[model samples]
Structures are given as structure tokens and as C-alpha cells.
Target: MQSSSKLFPVALISAELRGDLTEDVYLLKPNNSPDPSVELALTRLGRAGHDGARGVPVVLLHGSFANRRVWYTTGGQGLGAWLARAGFDVWLAEMRGHGLSPRNRLYRDNRVADYARYDLPAIAAFVGEQCAAPAHWLGHAQGGLVLAAALGGGYLAAAQLASLTLCGSQISRLHGVLELPPLIWAARLLLRRREQVVAGWVGPGEGYEEEPAGMVRENLRWFGRFGEGRQDWAAGLVEVTIPVLALAGAADRSAPPAACRQLLERFGSPLREYLCLGRAEGFAEDYGRAAMLLGGNAHNEVWPLLEYWLRHQRLPERR
Candidate 1:
């Protein structure tokens, strides 16, 4: 299966030596992409002493305006590193113009429609070739939406996926003004003069990278119709049948638990699970958006539940 990977065209850009693990970065340029200069980065983290024997392949995707740092810090302290240390073949993906991936010609014009239709399928195919097995996909925010779009559009086949996990992501929650097409159209029209939108200037976070206004436009469209281009992804979601795990933070007003549950309900999977992180859910605190994953107590509280689910495909027992 590994030998067949050569059939796909991928360029290995660099290999960085981490303490105990090796990080191999590959740039995948799918032939079908509208932009020939587009190259999506896929970073693989694994150790050598395991004799190349890998556990299940798991792909980690970052949210909007974020990068690979969401999964692993420079010090190798996040979930990507933890999963690598645990023997899972982990791959962290950087969407166009994010993290290690350089901006493509269409960077300003790229949207989730391009990501879900073009980038993700290429990533999955590359991972599938290397691992010779289906991957378990885990994403946060816009990353989750990309996964949903890929699954719903049939860009990613069920045979290429082991499971799906969504964190702090939902389309059910509507942003009143943001949901209006005319307003979004006006925003995009205004953004034509701007190259990128800084998360700190507009949203609640700091240190986030600048993102294409196209992403904001696409998200608004999803919030309004859950469809992109000509495809009705909202209607297509019911066709996804893989086991799914959806998580929400109790204090995450951005993506409330109720909204996340609505997204979970749309999946056709028989094995669907939902969990809300808060004192009511037996957690120490009511986790907010980033707090749910990167909080000080997450290592002891949240990470274990994620590991358990990735390993067992079931909810962990209440403490």
C-alpha cells in the first residue's frame, strides 16, 4: 500500500528533527486545483524507535485564522505531540495561507468551498497512501466545517475515513447580521480592497494570523444556507454514516452546546456521541472555546477523553 503512494504527486519540503520525534512536511498540489500554484502542507509526526509500526492514522486540522500551533506548540506540548507520543501516526494540516503553507495565487479568493472540494480530498488521499489505512479526522471550528463539507459532498469517501470528531463547530447557530447575504456581499465587496482579516482586530482572540476575507464570506454563507457554490451540503450531510463524536464547551457562546448538538443530529451515523465540557458534565470548569482544548487543566481533563475516544471510539466513563 505504501508503494502505491508514488502514484500521487507530492513534494516533501523539509524534515525537522524534534526531540524524540521526526516531523516530515509535504506539499500536495492536486492536479485538479484551479490554481496551479496551490500547495497544501501536511506535516507528519512520528518516532523512529517504533520501527515504523504505526498506530491508527489520525489527521488534525486547525480552525480559522489559526495554524498548526493549535495542535502542537513549538515545545511539542499539544494534542498532536501527545498523539505522536502515543504511537498514532498524526498528520497536521495547514490550510492555504495558514502556518507553513505558502499563499497560493488564489489566496485572497480561496474559500471553504475550495478547501472542502479540493484541498481535503488531496490530503486524505495522501494520508491514505502513506498509512495504507483510513484516517480518523479531528477538526476544530472551520476545520470541522471543512470535514463536514468534504463528507457531505462525497469528496471524501467513507472507505477513506475511520471516524469523525468535531470540536466547537456548528452551523445551526445563526449570526443575525452575518447571516444576511446582502451584508456578507457588502463585506466581501469591501474586503476586495483588503488582503486579509486580522482575528485580533475583529474577534475575541489575539495572536491569530491574518486570514482571507473569503473565509469569512464562505462562513457567512454556511451560517445562512449551509450550502456552497452549487452544492447543498446541509442536505447532503445525512449521507455521512461514519461514527461521529461532537464536542462543545459549555461556555462557548460562539458555538453553544445546543447548536453543536444540532450539527451532530444531522449526521447519519448510528454511533453518534455528544459531550459538553462544564461542571454539569463533571468537568472542573465550564470550558470556553479555546479553553476546552488548550486550558491549563485540559491535559488532565480533556485530552484523556479525546485519547479514549480515538482509541475506543466511545465516550469515556464519568469521573
Candidate 2:
């Protein structure tokens, strides 16, 4: 089916060998989307030894106000690098307007609905084609929201995924009245008066690409609502029987542990599991949204668990 579309997922632009890692970057454009011209960037990482193995692929999706680099930086101090070294075929997806992906024509008006319905499926299809098997997906923070929406909408078919993991992501958690409908609307009001929300300009994070105003408004509405405007999320989740993992941070007020649990409980998958990173859980320290992925001690503490999870998900080969 992917082969028939004019804007199908496979459009390889560059394949370069960088040391022990082989990096292949592709520009994916899904013709099924409202904007077929919207192009997303996907980066695949593998080693020469595993090139013949064709391990079931694992794709990493970053959260809002961030890009693909969040999964790995130049020094290779991120989960994407860690996963590759652990012998998993890794792919990093940069959503529209993030990282190396160029902003779409409707950049200011882009929303998560578009991402869930369009970008997620394309990433899955492309990775599945490259690996010749269903892929496991891990989404962090806002990326988790997008993944849930896609799963709910059935945009990510069950046959396309071996497992699903969500880290530091929930739709119903609200920090305060700051996310109330009134404040949300007000934020959109203020943002519409400008071009986009530049997080670093507004605060003290690294100056990355500004987020679309439409995305902010759409996400703000989800602060207190689960299944944000998704027509198929409830139905799609009811049919998902695959292994599912939802990871939360004990100290994360941004996406509280309880909220993450609520998301898992509401799902119909029987194999659903939850992990909270906290001292009580026998972790070194409580992990926040960022710390769960980028903390100094993640490699030593949580990454091994991630490695184990993916490795265990591999189906036993029949003789």
C-alpha cells in the first residue's frame, strides 16, 4: 500500500557512514494527509554488525518544543545513541517544523491531529519497510500524546507495531489554572498576535525552533481532556492487544505519575505496564520529563531497563 502512493514514505535523500554508525536520512511525505507537501525527516542508525541481523526497528519520537536532537546530540549522549549501541535498529523521527525537518506551509496552523493522523503512520510504515517487521515505538512527553492519538485513531495499525511505550506523557494532567480553558484561549490570543511561541525567548531553555501557535492552542485544550478531539482513539485503543508500557516520573508535576497511570488504566490492552522513576521505586533519584531521557545517570539507571524491554519484545525465531 505504501508503494502505490505518490508521496509514499520512502524517499531516501542521503545515506552516510559515520564511523561505526550508519546513518540514513529520508524525507517522508504522506499523500494521505491534508497537506501532502508536508515533509518529515527520519534518521535511521545502525551498526555494520547488525546490518545483517535486521533487528525489529525501534523508533523514537521527541516531545514538544524539541526536535530529533533531543534523542541524541553531537557527543552522542542520548537514548537514540544508547539504543543503537545496545544492538537495536534505531530510527529518530523529527516531526514537522522540528530539528532538521523544514516547517510546513501551514506552519503557524499545524496541530497534533495532523501529526497523529499523518506523520506517525508514515514513520511507522517507513521503519517497518526498512526492517521487514513490525516496529516498536517509544514516545516522550508531547510525543507520547501524539502516539496515543495516532493509536486511538487507528492511524498506527496493530500490525505495524510490536509494542508501544510512553514516557512522561499524559493529556489530562494540568499543573494549575494556567492551563484552564480561559488561560488556554488567552495564550492562543497572545500567540496569534505574534508568529509562534519561542520557548527559549520566553524563558531559559536552549533556543530551538519556535512551536506553532496552533499546536500550543490544541495541546492546551488537552490539559484536562483525554482523547483530545480524536474520533478513533477510544475505539482504536479498545482493539490494541500489544505490549504497552507507560513510564512516569514520581517528581514530575508536569505530567504527574497518577495521570500517567490513569492513561494506562483507561487503555484496553491487557499487557499494559507502568514504571515510575523515583527513590521509592529503587531508582537513584526522581526523574522528571527531561531527566528520564537526558539525565546524567539515565544511561546507568533507566536505559538498561529500556534496553531490556526492547530486547525481550523480540519474537523468538523458529528453526
TM-score, every prediction: 0.94, 0.89
1-319: candidate 1 lDDT, tens digit per residue: 1222464667787888888988888877776687888878899998766736988899999988799998999998898998899889999999989998899887888888888888998888889878877999999987898888888888888888899999988876644455566776777678777778898644576338888877776666565578767888877889888999999999887788998999899989999999998999889999987887789988888888999999999997896
Query: On a 0 to 1 TM-score scale, where does candidate 2 land against the true structure?
Result: 0.89
Q: In candidate 2, where is summed lDDT lowest over 10 consecutive residues? A: 1-10
**What is the per-residue lDDT of model 2 for residues 1-319, given as tens digits with 9 covering 90 to 100?**
2432243655677787766777878887776677766888898888755678755589999988898888877775588887887778899999998887888888888888889888887777767656777888999988988888888877788778888898988877665565567876777678776657887533354236678888877766666554554464644676777888899988787789998987777677878878888889888899887888888878888787887778785322212
lDDT of each: 0.84, 0.78
Q: Which stretches of candidate 2 lie over 4 Å from their true place?
A: 1-9, 200-207, 228-236, 313-319
Q: What TM-score, to 2 decimals, does candidate 1 have? A: 0.94
Highest-TM-score candidate: 1
Give stretches of model 1 more than 4 Å off: 1-5, 174-186
Q: What lDDT is obtained when candidate 2 is compared to the true structure?
A: 0.78
